[model samples]
Target: MKKIIICLAFSMLTWHSFAQDIPVKITKSELFKDEYKNSNIVLVEDDGSGGVVIVRSYAGGIFSSGYGYYFEHYDSNLKLLKEYEYQSKVKKEDKKIYRSILGVIMNGKEINMIEYIYDKKLQSVTFNALTSNINDFDFTSKELFNMNSKDAESGNSGKDRDAGAQMIINEDKTAFAITVDIKDKNSETHKIYLFDKALNQKIDHTFKRDIKDRKFIYENIDVSKDGNTLYLLGKVKTDEAKKKKDGGRYQYELTRITSTDEKTQVFDTDEHYAASLKTIIFQDRLTCIGFYSDRNDSRFKGISYFELDPNSLAIKKSKFNPFTEQFMIDKYGKDKDKELKNLRFKQLIITPQNEIILNAEEYYEVYTHVMTQNGGGYDRWTYHYDDIVSAKINSDGAIVWARNINKRQDTSVYGNPFFSYTSTAKGADAYFFINTGEKVRKIRKDRIEFKEASPKRSNLTVIRINENGDFDYREVLDDEENEVPFMVAYGELTGDSVFFLGQKGKKKQLLKLTL
Candidate 1:
């Protein structure tokens, strides 16, 4: 084991902003210091009053059978306080691709690390749950289970869905929810599994619904505060039906499951088609909000928001077309008839002033192919991440102001999304850390131009938007002048301080920037 500390000094580490200079420091991991190149990595993080808790897994790709995991605790300055390496027993080579996911959990006095090793088969999925206690640095439990997926039995047709696919373990480590959609006995159905703190099966129920013509897409899962109930939310899709002018819509469904019985509510959006439906759980009730399109299209036209009772699955009140025209211009150089397309909303934020600040970004995908000796290759995708929007809405479901953070980012490779952007708010003001090309032109207050980034010329800009829908940009980290890492959008925003992972030229470190 090594001390694993590399010191890199910035121009000003003390609160690095106009208000106060945030002290920035970098903590190199033992993996980075040892220069382990054969390791596949997955990082899970959660912030605490003491510091940030991080659980990391290092292993080989799909061909490898073992995993090396560790847990580290960091202080306010991103300094490592403690570290414990975990040993895994999943070293058996099955010659199949296995997906691994890492999760961080603060259970009482100990930090629990959860890893899911799952593989999809023709008709069923083998899901292995592994848990380790970081405080004691020992394995706690490893459970393997099988569930149904797709329609492999009738001829190995339909989609190759993961039977025991979606899993969510609550933060308190009290309850875990698993939902899967499978073709059971020639019927398209869904199953919900509830487990206890010991990962023991508590309740298992199969959903009774006639969704033969529709496909189930899961969205979110929430557990009751009393630990007595679980809720699942999702959408059901259909093919286009032109006769009735129905291009089809994703009907919303919220299911509430108790230990004995389950209740489900399946409803539809009258005229607008929803993009992505999300559920926000509150102390008293649950709310779902999403953007909508005019018809069956995916382009966002307005906002759809409503609150419902958690137990009955009944709507208390609902509001439609809740968004005013945002400050936007389409790619054609003129204003469009509605809000720009590809605007995906993120987690809603509540401010000290009791205002709801909704943040969204323009994102879309492109498909391409390569001509080969075999005529054509499989389709490849490129993701373009563009401008960001931050809107302040009142308690009465009204938009007070909408601010747009202009940017354009592109990458040739797939799966990386090319770039990233995020926001951190204080009081009524919001700050954003955006990644852009070094040669990208200055964006006018109301307009922006798209430019591809030069290789190794990416920089991070800190833009602050006031309450009045006004914004100012500052390029704090430049790769040309300093070793300012190109990745700042990955930071976690806490109070007035923000922390993220950065690589200066090639040196990786945990960066702390205070606004």
Candidate 2:
């Protein structure tokens, strides 16, 4: 195993005008020594104390050690306490076809590493939980579940749909849930599991009744604090829907699973279609917020909110608010084609006051064919992360205001990790952190745009939107003052503070923003 290096120095950055009104404190650690630049922060968790635990994974190939990880622990004062190198056990001789780390969890006195591995020779896929004590740091692996790869490959027909395992952890981190879907030509099967923070399995059941007429894809899952109940939110597709199409032909469904029975609610109305939906248990109530579109059309028209009975999955209150005029102008200016499509849900924050701050981004992919000299061709894909639409919903389920942030980013040159942004909320104000070029262009009186910036000369910018939907942005960290570039998309938000890891070449640093 390679001995990991660590060096840390702390400094505070001064904020600009608007941030001064509410005091945005920036604490940064100087660049530390690292051997691999192909690393990204996967988790930044607060250890019950004021300290934090940061975990990053470094890439490895057949020539080098297999994929490995670095676990760094820091005190509340931003000083490094300890670092651990989890050398990958999978060598080239292992012949593992595919592997991915789902998430890294830090519980009371333990660290849980949840991962998925596919074995080509055995034709099996396994979900394993690697557990280590905080004091001992020695890991033990346990297989939580397994599936046959043949069933997954034969059932999956599209690129967007994933037939493997999916994991979700609740906001409080008390429990987590995992769902796996296996489908074949004749039948389909679904498995849902709930586990406590200590990796104790609470509920394990197979769901297969709802797959005869339609296919269901679950996007969100949450387990109760006690790990006794499970909730799932996803989209359902019926035979009426055409191939390679999206819109009203599909409907959103909420399933509540308990130890005894399961209840479901389909959120399909005659007037509008739910383009996207995300759910959270706030104040002991099952609440959902998402975007809606006019009948059958995939283009979004407004925001949608619903309050449902937690146990029965019954809708108690519902509201659909159209986009405001100012929001349309902010997004489209004077263009005749004002349709908003391909908006994926990014963040949904419920404040202490019971208000909701919702955000989504315009994202899509374009694939092109490149020909070779032998009359054969290969497919190349480009990912686009574009404009962001943000809105605020009052406690009564009415949209207070909606706004759009203009930006354009693609993965043709730079990677997708540097394109999208991260968000956190403080009181009534919502903050979005992104990386932009040297200058942000102000095209309109109140609108500004963020263009693609190079990694070396990027500006870590923060856009703050008040409760009234009025927003202002400024550079929190400029390129000249900072040597390491911040990966805004990889930030971890805990309460009012968010932590980001900045890395450039063989140097990396930790950045903390107190909003």
Candidate 3:
């Protein structure tokens, strides 16, 4: 559940404090048969019996009807033990379909698979749990809830697409919340449902407000430690004319929900604008933090933090810390016009000492035209994943250190499936695993760069940032020695281990890294 890593650009910092290289191991599975060659891993978990459970979806494979799943059980040695193929109940007639996996958790000796499904005939959406025994693979299904969907949002643009629904699990995974937006006359209505890990419903409520002048676009959600309260963050859209006078057309709002009442708080600052916001409970307090800009320009100016009253959703303590000079130099070198923009939050880590580590990446899109030989052309799109920014904030909401990692990667592919990095924390230190081909180099007195690398023939490099903000890098998997490229972005962190799935055509393997 803790996903994070750090990159350093300070030239004077020291190297890794650890004496030895981090332990890593790669285990290759038997070549998947041609019939199931195009499968991708959807879930991986430790079986609690010196083995692992991996679930793969072959929905778009040559032999699949776009609804088949492969459930595999493997021993400690990565040897396949047993496997089963399961398909969903689907109709191809004249109906829109939507299904998205919520999560999977172990229940006794069985695994409970939770999914959100849209029932076309009934004109509604339902949460369903499919339980499968680990020993004999016996299967059963039960409906968790069925709700109206006449004007609800749907995510069914194509096969294997995610539904327009979102779910958030608490730190302990003991409880979860699902939120949906329904179309109304001029704005939108929100549906919030809370449930325990055992598929028991806790609260079902709906909220409607701000419909006359603005609409709320929900972004993130979090639950309290006891699962009795829910927090929702969203962007409140105002009139477009406000952009010319105030330089911003949107403001941030935080909504707190309980079984009996709902409250909302709008974050309005006269001097600055919130570019992004995420909520987390730290030190027994509800805290909201993100990036902000002096003007409503797309560029960010610094980090923002706010400690809120748990019951009122009101800001009790707040700070807006501007980026240090060294961080700006690390990102733009000497370019005065270049600025940081399009940062999407990736990981939020809270240390033992109550320090917060914030991580994000620069992502954007571009469109062009590719002409064919016949003199006709088609539009081409490229998704860019460019840079990494990390910062450490102390208990007083003061930023202690902030750094940026420079890299450039782009792909026209839909998933961008293999480009981003995955992270795990080692105490106060952070480690990032990425695929890169170029050598690490110092670009300036305060700038360090990790050049973009080919995804197919790249080295798996691990970047380490110690507690003091000093950092170093090492290649764990050399491209020449390893043939399969890992989908590093999809790696899962479990205890002291990280699991990743590697695939190349008809060949697939499982890679485990022990920290």
Candidate 4:
């Protein structure tokens, strides 16, 4: 009986160890190391074809005139496969000219690279398509599109010719090049070109819009998952009367375009405000989440959802509004005098079930008072702090749960707090919040609730939340011995493994977590 009891205990211990999840092991390799230090590595994609293409940028170099370097390829295990370096033939006696590579994409078996070359005699752009399989990579392919700096500059004004040229590659390996050109009268116009998989120009379109005392700044244009729709987000100016009437508001629009249409459908928001739109395709249905806010506001007062008809490029029934009154009143009491107003939503994410998670923040001023019981005078001071809030809403616009992330007397860093929520490969979601506060008088200012002293320099909190917003497990990454500041910029569920892009020792590192 004693031996049997001892054997049972050993079996249980072994089972527990086997069930524990461990972090993924990472091995570092120098893909490119020569004359260039502190290079920016843009990891494009792991083309299940057993290779990954990385574009390294030399912001400024002694021999280079501009900011980009070249394209380097690595095998599935990160072994250096091949490299294509660019060199200009232009001769100059002054300082060395530089050429920078901007965009790259894999077209079938070949790879396409774009570079911006700057020299005393000439400033131009170069496009090249190279393949690892030389026999299959045809240079004589008429489907290839190549544009030089002169062609790109022809659309720009004297201010900064290189400022507006940006490119995007679609799902079918087609490319769209967008450039902003300044007219003779100093007005700006946008030009968009569509190129085929082989880089040949398929269509060219240009349009101009008038603005009152406002210069056009190009932001971002993304091709939708269906490969037919494009979404453009950018800012515009408002006339004086419109600005004053709308509380100093400017106009921002979310424009969507399709191949069959010549005019784009523009969704304009109120002025002095900005908006962000996130679209996801789930189970063959398209869903969009948009957040809008004013310039100085931290809380997003507007939230909207839209279901689109992929074939017609039209929104089916879209609903938009501020947070529901019941949700606001429940978390922040219904006291009319103590109402939390002017809050703005910052982030919006959708779960697998089509539920929406919104995170918002509000800023307010408070007065701090100190009293003395003895024969002493009372003292008072005023300070400002931002209240961070999070809420989970269902597909029907019902709030499932809500909470405020801020604590009393804790000084929150404006624009410095880290916010992220990601889904793991195990179908579980993990939410992370890291707040970096200023250390004063040897006292730790910001700390995660219920957790022990976090890293004095930086604090990190990781919580695993269920699909219904229920907490399952939580982990605090800060330890006494490991005081370094760690951060996660990107995360993905690759196959059965979870990969995370983070930083340690000022060098970017990748973390893999496995179950």
Candidate 5:
């Protein structure tokens, strides 16, 4: 008998499969409490050991008071190990407190915690009173870094920094932090600081740019697993050729920064800025992937991948339009308007094997009608149609397969046409999970399609594809009604049981399956 087994570590279940199965049924379980209902949860493996660590937040005491974030350690069996919480005050006079937990890092034997507090009194729409604190904690003792009473009044440069910080640990156990400065006039100035594992400061570096009218937006940063190299991702804005009456420009440069030989190298491209970019670094290759959209035309978007030499940090466009020519032609059609040909890529994914998958949602125009009093009749109204498409490309940017997921529909606004496409070792599949309306559509190697319905049909769906690029299975759980399966994660062939993260009413639960 072919069986699939899934395991749930904490409130979340990571699915792994050993074999393949078609038309598999997913079960559900109640693993534990739903403590992180409103807060985002980052899952970290336990210090190269076994187990998991969760860093989360709680609603502050008073309204508009912000959040009180905390960290909890758990074992492989989902047993809680320890929990820690921290709070911050924004200003001296404002009794109200607004706090946020930015990021968390785990070194060999210690856990590093960082947070930010915003005060209303010393605040401006563009700037506010902010304080950042870093703490190092072990099982028995805790040490606060750069936390001196005298240092508070000095307004030391670190006190006013932004709360969005990232931490990376070196091979020697030292830690480094990179944070963006929103208060800087240039908005392109970013701060980088290095620290020992004990949270002691080492070297402080700053990267500043002087492009007029263009602000810098920091996207993400990472340190090499060995800790010798640091990678910074951001975008630079440029003034539009022509200014609008509303006071904003129309051009920008997407930028990347890499540190080597104690010096930083910058790579700037004239691509439109995007909200986020994902970077993956292997032993010899560094890959950067970002989804870009043209502001002048919302429909113009695409995914661009850059391969950089780790030592020199020089970027060469690795794979542009990896998807096949036929795939693109079939989706857009030869007769479509030129603007349709320029549709933007809204979603993209890179597989472990280095293959790039690009998904683009078509764009359309919307027209509104203004009623005329003299005409005694309503004016005609018209709207544009946007197409939804998905395409697969090889490592060299050659299209492997392409399909149009949506045509034009009058009942709905094309539902944003962009579908979530990720590479799985089992194969490739498209996922769509909206709250209360979750559904998993699986396309197998044989071109067979299977779907698992979401419970509560709450539109919230979780889909998992194994490392082999094949559809492992899917889980749909809802508490509004008690009609959930026993487990959620059922591998394709390892075992008959399924593993799942379940939600019942107000509680988040987990369960194991034995079908």
Candidate 6:
């Protein structure tokens, strides 16, 4: 047995990854109630001191789904620790309510559900829900912000409107922040609220800016660990750009929003095209990365990366293409036109040693014939995946290593959940879980391909990448006969094991894999 170790900033977990038959303990927890059939719920992280604390709540009422809220907590072993129901003493009509999750905050032993209540008639929405203790669950409510709704007739934000408010809490729990984005067509505005440990508002501001004819398309926004600054990654889309200058139609955009100042920055590469620009915060620095394609082409021909200081908006590293020439030749041969395009960047993993790993899969779309009730119809759908390429960027911004797990596959169905893999990084090595078709064999081409099968089968495969950039592959759960529904889950790496909740039809199955 080989012991696998992971170094997490807040905690640690150890597990064994053996090649032999590893017995897994599966525990099926039936969480679906009659009302919960909707599946709109909340899950809180375990403090990991005594017993794991889990929360299950309803949007409307407790029993009849009328008003107020319901909460239930359980231990690590799925044993009910206690439960509580918070409602108005003077109950009114069972009208519907609109709400959205800002985020969850864990202070001491308390798990706070920072949420907002929306009202169309009123100018602003209300924010509340905080748990001081299990029994003393405090309920604080207030109107937080005011904005014009997409539909004016309703006079409210829409009785069932959820603006998709996001919440962020600092590691020490001394600070908390809630952010909501209002998108209009291609343009968007972000509403941010900063709070102190006592749930007092420290700063409240709204960021709305237009760049002439270009609309600011917001990506992922990060609130610095200290809870003082917000780094927003967006794209400016314009169709009027001169073809000789602008590659396709968009520019890489980023905005730093603070109390006193707001700075918008753009990355100009003359004719280089960009797709799927994303930001990842590590240490105190923010890294923005995505794939670079040819002019007017969305298919990726290369990759681009840069590091920036969130506080000063200074470029710590000039933009660099870490995709080496040797890597391209090795994967796609010397034919530049036949090179690996359509590389879908799945994730960015940074290690404790400042090693950056970029994980991507070769994905594209194809139009084909399908059987319809009337006759043969030409339909369009996405053809996902082949070969997962993992590149390691060194501490000094140098390309250190690039490894890959060869897989040529496409599902009979559509959607990303059926194609892409989920991963967890523990120290230098990382693990991935994705469904694989029959075992891959040796091949010589631009990319590897899987042999044809009568009926495609999905086997949950586990891929491990070691510190030295070595690769290991194994099938953890096999469904070759296609009798079981394919399970796709992202598991948490706990102490010496992984805990995952997989959905099989309407039921939820929990598995504890101890290496």
List the global CA lDDT of all models: 0.58, 0.76, 0.72, 0.44, 0.42, 0.56
lDDT per residue for candidate 5 within 397-513, as digits (tens), equals 454555544333221233311122211222344332212223323343223232223333332233343333333333333434333222221111112333234344444433332
Q: Lowest-scoring 10 consecutive residues by lDDT in candidate 2?
A: 153-162
Better of 3 and 5 by TM-score: 3
Per-residue lDDT of candidate 3, residues 20-126 (tens digit): 45544544554344345555666667788877887776555444445656777887666678877776645577357667676666555677777887767778888
Ranking by lDDT: 2, 3, 1, 6, 4, 5
Give the candidate number with the greatest lDDT: 2
Give stretches of model 5 more than 4 Å off. Answer: 1-37, 47-50, 61-66, 69-98, 117-176, 195-203, 213-219, 237-279, 291-297, 322-350, 356-456, 459-505, 510-515
Off by over 4 Å in 3: 1-34, 38-40, 49-51, 61-63, 75-79, 89-100, 156-163, 212-214, 238-247, 334-338, 371-374
Residue 371 error for model 6, in Å?
5.3
Judged by lDDT against the true structure, how good is candidate 6? 0.56
The digit string of per-residue lDDT tens for model 6 on 1-515 reads: 11112221221123334573333333323332223322222444555554444443334445544333445455555444565655433234313445555555555666666766555445445677555565456655544444554422132344223245667665345676776655544335567777765566767777776553135555666666666766777776655443445475666678877777888777654577776666766666777776676654556665667777766667777554535554554466533453356777676777778677788877777777677888767665746567677777765555676655666656555653345665656677766767766665656654443432222246666677777765666666566423332334344444444554443344333334434
Q: Write the per-residue lDDT of candidate 2 for residues 1-515, one digit (tens) a residue.
A: 32335544445756545544546788876567665556778777787788878788888755665677888777776777777888666667776567777777777878999888888888988889998876567889999887887755422445235466778787778888777766644444567888888888888877654454235665677776556788777777756553424346666778888867887898764467776678877646788888888744568888888989887788898888888887888986743335688898788887878788898898888989999999999988888888988898987889888988999877764455666899888888888999898777777655678897876568888888898888888778788878788888778887678888887767677789887
User: Which of 2 and 4 is ahead in lDDT?
Assistant: 2
Error of 3 at 12 (Å): 35
lDDT of 1 at 271: 68
Clashes of each: 7, 0, 0, 23, 48, 8
Among all windows of 10 consecutive residues in model 5, the one with the lowest summed lDDT is 485-494
RMSD of each: 5.1, 3.8, 6.7, 11.0, 10.0, 7.6
- Alpha carbon lDDT of residue 105, candidate 4? 59
Per-residue CA lDDT of model 1 for 104-129, tens digit only, reads 44544455444444345444554555
lDDT of 4 by residue, 361-429 (tens): 554545555657886766454323344556665666555665444322233332221222233323434
Off by over 4 Å in 4: 1-37, 47-98, 108-110, 118-163, 169-188, 196-202, 212-219, 234-260, 266-288, 293-299, 306-315, 321-461, 472-487, 490-509
Q: What is the lDDT, from 0 to 100, of the residue 116 in candidate 5? A: 43
